[model samples]
Target: MATNVAMDKKPARQTVPNAIFSLDVVKEKERYDLWRESIACIFEVDGDRALRRTSDFKAHVDANMFGPIMLARTWTQQQDWKRSPSIMARDGMDHYMIQLFEHGQMQWEDGTGLRELPKGGLIVFDLAQAVKTRTNDFCNLSLIIPRTMMDGALKPQFDQHLRVLAKGEPMVKLLRDHMLSLKSVSDRMSVRQAIEVAPATVGLAAACLNAAVDRENPHQGAGIALAQLTVIRRFIEANLSEPALSVDWIARHAGASRTKLYKLFDAFGGVGTYIRDRRLRRALLALVDETAQYRPIYDIALASGYTSDAAFSRAFRAKYGIAPRDIRGNQARLVDIGLPTDDKVDRRYERWLHHLSV
Candidate 1:
């Protein structure tokens, strides 16, 4: 029999927000020139920076739903490129800027400290700050989002760590991927999609900021730490049957060092103890599985990573105040034993079976 199935090729129509700009064109040098012209125009009209024609530059501006974020590469022959004092006056309008160096080095006085933003590093500054950034020849990415949009996502405590060089993280990779995807399908996104995308973008931005900042509220930070801990614990539970699952393995899977992994588990108990407890608990559950009625206690222990029946029995007795044999015996007698017949008993048994399968 031959079957024909039609597949839809067009995207679904949704209420999409207006897109500001997309990096559609890739004229590298021309893009940079455009950025320089725009900056020069701003400086000329507002008299913010002491506009110096000391460097040849190139930039590309990719507009988002709210505003434009630019990737700029520029060279400077002189060291006098600085922002004018009048620039600080206009900064009250609340313009935010983040500069990440792709190559070369740059220096700036960030009021609190003289920050040196090296290659692969980032610096964030408010237009209102009396700060001046200087570089001989630097290539960088600059992101400019509305201040109102940023205010909603970032906590006031993270203000100091606003500009951060991203270390390797899944969230960072996700944002980079999303940016690339946005560039590809800029015109396809509907107005509603654009609006929805903004919140997702903010969530990623907030995560990045959270990674960079040291929170004043230790309690709130602890909650985030606990959530991450839960993820690690869940991973441990899923792979308990694998004999090779050790502390090092768990650390590698959790994207944390062995020491950090141990510390995270130490809040409940030591990692070694936790692993043993979890294995024993899983073995106990498997012993009660009604579908596995024919399986021996030794087989259940072995499946849960215990090598010897004697060793497994000793641990099981220590944990549950009874030997594995007694536990299995009790489970087997559940059908034969006379007990009170109630709706509660039936519901509890059904729930237990469902949990065992899970």
Candidate 2:
């Protein structure tokens, strides 16, 4: 019972508050130790590293947290970070960090493998996993979230098979822009408002990294391909009325091969069928709007990317089992024709996102 009681006490964690630090304030010899303690509180990283040059230790820090997720901006000289098994056991946190390297070179090795951190790179690091990072002078921005939150949003295999997200990857660019956008206004945001925005960031990050992992797994044959397909479907939805919504266009923009693209949407009967079905759904919504009743079906069909009303009507009936005009001017009423829907994905992302709100 005493041992159980001892285990019940929570270990100390860094405070979620506004903070700042500067190496200029400390004596040269003492600055290295001060940096270690300051950074531990800043990142909840209570591991070990030896400064390569203590005589002229130089770093500046500014940090904030929306909630459990934190953003830290750091400038440092070279250091070799070594997180040992014992250090991890004593750290008292379980989380993952997606760090953006703005200006620096970091070569990191862990259970996965070693890779030179890309310029303007965003990479994920798991606190529970041992990692070694050898870096030259560098500046970085990092987003830290609990392990469970990321696991809910991304694939379960993410931590087990970690990889560096190279610069210019679509998902990497999206996440980089997202974090930078939030930072531009974070200083004015209240803790509660910032908290609300945290999960959406996590969702976007998960979607981005999921794309990276999926892109690497074409050889493995369908390792979380649904997440990648979700990305393509979203791209398609946004461009439904586009003249470039053809398979070749999607394959090119989405960086998926024609064969790979076809395999991903096989359950939807085929890519063309899926695109045609979704276009009709959008047209049905537009047609049912009372404000849009003045528009002719022929005009609606053309805007819906159909060349002719006859082609649109035939596709619409085959999908919704009813003529498009039947639902006209219905004013937001959803007429259920019970068309086959795709679960091509899961709702786990919602739960992951909700975790940030709390």
Candidate 3:
């Protein structure tokens, strides 16, 4: 005389590495304070008394990280933002930020001088430098990328900070559309897919920057090497899966000499090492992706240009100190380097910024 019973079980929720902060959810009295604290990592923010009032405070942000790059769409009331020498020394980040204002206006002063950013203007900021800005109630999209990722794309002394491009230019429009497209589809992209897309996005950004520089100064020959290296890097990213992706093939295709190509990547360990590192990293991501669990290890190895399973295993172990299958589905979560351990403080955005690395 046993009775049958049904068991109640709920599926575990999937976690995505994204942040959305809206002032509407915060208590009225704490909204402005929370907003200022949330952005403390990148900017010291404050507003006029009227905008800072409990009843008047308003801000919203949606941010997503794709490997070494981050894209954010933000809306806020009038505020002042500053990045001083102390803040730069404390944070120790030298990343590049490309911001596009969709509405409202802003006036900023940096080492270059004071400038105004009107609606539909795109500007670049170098985080290593000092700057201050006062803005009208505004909405904007920001793309933040590490300087390491721009290695071959931008010259070290380019002085591109505060460089603005208006929406009227065809190249600017294309660049804006590309960044927006990535944002729109980011939610559906897996960690592996996002990592793969980062390089291409950087390439488009470099193209826009180089075009701007060429138009501004035709006599500047300093960027020739930068442009050549950019082409080589983009070619490497596009053909990482090909087994024949070698220095000779890349040199021929990218119009660079073998010696020049080798020299260009010398700082990053030679050209061969760069290709091997990128391929191994891609394979590692694919192996850890839960959505790609059904894919065979051999298939992943082949895609990474390793035809032999043993070779792939040996190379993977040598690089990561673990077998390819050891941490497959067990470690599907995104790894955040240098994230804060204290949970009592709400620094989610700061954690995300810290997690960004090359």
Candidate 4:
């Protein structure tokens, strides 16, 4: 977007120095050294052998902090970039890089088999691990997730096994498109807006990593199940008026079994209970609206999937300790439904956010 061309690096914000940066690789007599510095500054890694080949290098970076995680994107061309054992020892290591490559002929090794990404692909490699890379032209959007922030994300076996995400994989493609969109609009964002998007960045990256790893292992990824639960929740909300919306339907929609669906929604109680509670919750909102008074209770009941008014009324009273008609008379507003309605779900999310801050 708005790039500061060939200028010295300066802090975008006083409080957080790394909000954004732009550098145009100025070609001077010692331009090779400057290129090396540019690569190091842009990627926060070491050993830029590409500067030896050509001095034509320029890059821009937009970095935002979400808790301790940093979301960043760089558009630049450099040849070979390596993070060797010496660099690791010198820099000290406690972070991992998850990169979505847009263009590059990159052959990178992390003491495992080499992953050569020429086109579209993503890579997740830890800094504590060994790294050596040879590349022709490389450009990417990446995130730096501190090891502590990755607590529930990376298992030991996964850290050792899954590193590169192939171009055509579903999760990789989705994350790539997502980051591209984020980058396109990032220049217009404020520090507050950038901070607000950090959790989304973490969640999306975590989901993609888990999906890719589970796909490789073929043991039915729990990550996929967790991600799919979010989709199913939206589906349930959209179809609450339908009479056939049930636990079986939700399981089928999620591609999860009835048992798995039950477990996924255990925090909200059983699947059926959750669906009923949500429907009743919506019905409560409708019941309190003056605009909806023209519609009879039986109509609202049927719309909420009840066969008759009696069943809906009984369920409503059992849940709320009041008849449906009484809500309007008693001036029941949104507080009558209670805040959030699920402490178990809220606490679970609170703990996840806390881990990110750590």
Top candidate, metric lDDT = 3
Q: Give model 3's TM-score versus the native structure.
A: 0.60
Q: Which residue pairs does candidate 3 place in steric collision?
A: none
Note the Cα lDDT for every prediction shown. Answer: 0.50, 0.64, 0.74, 0.59
Tell me the TM-score of each prediction against the true structure.
0.39, 0.51, 0.60, 0.48
The worst-scoring run of ten residues by lDDT in candidate 3 lies at 332-341
User: Which has the higher lDDT value, candidate number 2 or candidate number 4?
Assistant: 2
Q: How do all the candidates rank in terms of TM-score, highest first?
A: 3, 2, 4, 1
Model 2, TM vs. native: 0.51
Give per-residue CA lDDT, model 1, range 308-351, as digits (tens).
88988998888666776776556433322111122211112212
When 1 and 3 are scored with lDDT, the better candidate is 3
Sorted on lDDT, highest at the top, how do the candidates line up? Answer: 3, 2, 4, 1
Root-mean-square deviation per candidate: 24.1, 21.9, 12.0, 19.8
lDDT of 3 by residue, 202-236 (tens): 98887887676644543234345544555576678
lDDT of 3: 0.74
Cα deviation at 302, candidate 2, in Å, is 73
